[model samples]
Target: MNRFAALEAFVRVAETQSFSEAARRLRSSKSAISRNVSALESELGARLLNRTTRSLNLTEAGRAYFERVSRILADLDDADRALGQLQASPRGRLQVSAPMSFGFLHLAPAMPEFLARFPEVDVDLSLNDRFVDVVDEGFDVALRIGALPDSSLMARRIAPIRRTLCASPDYFRRRGTPQTPEDLKAHECLRNSNVARTQEWRFVDENGKPSLVAVSGRVSANNGDALRIFALSGFGVASLPTFIVGADLRSGALVSALDRFVPQDLAMNAVYPHSRHLSPKVRAFVDFLVARFGKRYWDPDDGRP
Candidate 1:
């Protein structure tokens, strides 16, 4: 028995929870995959999987073994990728995760050029607003916006994410413009329900002091694009990222306020699992993003008051 092939078969079967699926992924017969996994289990004198007629579940030992074995496979793949980096081009499927709004407005548009540049690379892009576990989800890299928490994953800043307070001109006309952060309390504000403390908006005052405002609104949405739509339709004042509202602000569909108090700036980042040898596809994609948006090119100068 090929020990490495058996290990790969076991890992794939554990991940897919099906001999057939594992066989398909590994490009082998189901019998072959089952034989390899059975051989591995026999060698270790442990039943790695608890199989039922309709379902397959990992035994406790299997779970622990899967964790270690997956990492080992990843390291081996990284070693291969490191050697391949010396070649002229990167060739592989790059799985990337990005926020819905940014992926739609920015990243999606840039893909054509990237694909054109790297003919050998294939991209699998997942657009979601929720936080994704990069390693567990098996993503090559994830594009994240805003302040990142402490994590073991490696991150590279692709660009600065600037946010602003904005509303439709009609709304500002109907309701007087706010002169101070305290004034937000008197007006309806569009809140993002996805973020922590959805009603609390943070800002930096002119004197470089932090100011927290407890804002309220009749309408709240989990998505920034939804909030931007609400703000554009004269629903209320929405604190939104410039990337979402830059075009509208420039076109007079939305106008920024409170230019004196700077909104907290976040960063667009590419995060990947830390590996001794980074994959060339991940490296190239991150580099492409840094070169594309490093200068805040998407921001509009006249968006603010």
Candidate 2:
């Protein structure tokens, strides 16, 4: 005799005012319904129904309990429905993480159009070069460049980013271009703080041969944008991403050095948590990134999946 089941049977009989009708509505045998009601009355020590030969009626106490229990169950159902609605709609804040230079140059510019499309979504953006813990930081998605370390995070490739050693024409004019990897030792250089190996750079040629060159620099910065500025100001030769110095190479403001050496360009990615259910907002933003930034500008070099 489950107490809740007995209460439900009692409430059903009171509302319908007939044991046979309550049994039919509840899809249970009439005898089982009667047994549950009897158990409930025995526990309460009160006669809840006035069972007459011709008709059924509720005792005053039964009617009062029915009013309270029915409203409680109804409110619980209403709350569940409200939460279901919220889970399906895309009206909420979406937090995103990205590198500083790319956020300022590429991602920030696309945000206006993204907001114009999904006006209901509030975008919260954080920019940095350090790896972010998406779940701990409460970010919806993170835009990452270069190679990502092995992890459990779900990643979607968006574009390819290439790293190259570049020098301004003024600097090249003054010190001359270094045709061979070893010749870089003779020139002033700009370096990034996170270079995996000091004085060592790796490259994969067009034919897929691998080589490593030891490099040294006069100036080093933790941020790639700073290194780009240093290269532009002729401070030294900077090893930087193609996106930062791509236009400069085409415009002849900078020239690629030791073309025979540099890391292979890599696909950029938008990574997120893998879980049971993705909120509508996360789905919408990823689709927006694919639709907006899914140009061939991504895989410029050897095109492969």
Candidate 3:
């Protein structure tokens, strides 16, 4: 028999002073309650109650045990209640993992508003270019771009991430603008080494067909920001995410090339371990991300030219 169950049964019977009343409160039969109390007495080698023809009363040992265990049970109940409150309210540290560029450019900026809305939640945001095992690393949520592979994790699409092929006006003026995808071969292209095929750029042709071109340049870097900087200084054309280049393109510091050949947009996703029983902090942060970026914030207008 479970010692805790037996103790609970004895406490209930002693408090009620009636086996039948205790059974009713516990939603069990009187015989079961009597047996539990009997088991508790056998386990402890002590009789806990005196049963008379018309009444029941706790013995000296029973009264003392009841006083101590009842307080312990009450404290356990209070602990459970406190944990339930923490689960119900967003009032704890929320550990998040995200890509370095996206985290710094987008998530870092929006954090003030998120904290203002959920003043109770504290955020521990970790940014890195490398992928992390969220469960192993103890992260509550992670942000990813593009489609996720088959996994036990759940994902929600937050926004669209569009990539743009761009270069500074001076570079385009010096190198001459390429009218067709094949023309890119003659021009230098700054590459981001993180891509699977750094030399290859994919696009959709004017006929809505897939097209690819092998590109090479003097500079190649693992960071997108670095590539963007090189492209800005008139070094070479670079393919970069709209979030990184959108402002520069709008400000005319960078001009987009081959707009007609823009590829399909990738998705920004908030990924978590489980779909069910999501914590209040994670749910609130995800909802904030969706609401905060209901529309593509970077490309407020359809990117053209």
Candidate 4:
């Protein structure tokens, strides 16, 4: 009495003009096929078939229903094939969410190569500093930095996010450099207001001893790029990820402070709602990111801040 099965049976019998032939094509008993078609006609309250021992023919209503149902069945088959192909290969639109700074500085620059390698994957990237609900927002994947909170989302670490407390050389000259985590209190610190504890900076010493320092700043921003710009202009010392300030540190535009103590390192993770039966596009993109940013690509070669 399944309606779709009945519809399918009716269409098959009408097309072949024989219940026996339709049953053979469908691998079902002829009686079952006849019963299904009869159920369909009874439900519709219409005589769909005119039958005799010599020949079988469709009524006018049967012709109209068959036309529409056959098209629907064909479309359903096409959709099934398309979904199967999509699962088999990394093809179709991939919706990705990422942070503004990392997306702009790294992810966007790497898109050309990713697209070249995965030509069938069309990427739609959204960059924002705010945390997005992957399931609710319909994102296929999202790039998250720092420690992740407890969640139902599945995550894979893509890279290590090492941070450094640094300022321009000119600023160090004017305000003096901080030699210890405590000295940060006396300096003009630039904070990222996006985090919950904006003023609290955590560090670990060479022996792995942790220290929490409460810092104040004249300026605070939600975006890392804006904070990096402020630090580059000698406005204040900013605690920033090496990814954003790595080149600047290497070029001596910014100088590190409290070298003996390392800022609590974070990890860049790619998060998705489900792990089991993950789509090829999400797997490919996450694997690409992991391979691209091996170990400490954003950090200096010598591993100095």
- Per-candidate clashes, comma-separated: 0, 1, 0, 0
Per-candidate local distance difference test? 0.88, 0.77, 0.84, 0.86
Task: Give the TM-scores of the predictions, in the order they appear.
Answer: 0.88, 0.66, 0.71, 0.71
Q: Taking the tens digit of each residue's C-alpha lDDT, what string does model 4 give over 1-305?
A: 99988888888887778899889988999999999999988999999999999999988888788767876775666566656745587878999999999999999999999999999999999999899988546688999998899987899999878888899999999989888888889999899999999999888878888878999988999998999999999999998988899899889999988766875568899999653356778889999999998566667676443
User: lDDT at 23 for candidate 4?
Assistant: 95
Candidate 4 worst ten-residue window by lDDT: 78-87
**Local accuracy of candidate 3 as per-residue lDDT tens digits, 66-157:** 76776566456556665575568687899999888888998999999999988999999999978777654567899988778887677899
Q: Which 10 residues in a row give candidate 3 its minimum summed lDDT? A: 296-305
TM-score of 4: 0.71
Task: List the lowest-lDDT window of 10 residues for candidate 2.
Answer: 296-305
For model 2, name the residue pairs that clash: 159-268
Predicted structure with the largest TM-score when compared to the true one: 1
Give candidate 1 misplaced runs (Cα > 4 Å).
38-61, 302-305
* Candidate 1 residue lDDT tens string, 100-139: 9999999999999999999999999999999998866778
Q: What is the alpha-carbon lDDT for the whole of candidate 4?
A: 0.86
The better-scoring model by TM-score among 1 and 2 is 1
Scored by lDDT, the top model is 1
lDDT of 3 at 96: 94
**lDDT (Cα, tens digit) per residue for candidate 2, span 151-207:** 867888886667778889899999998877667778887767765675666666667
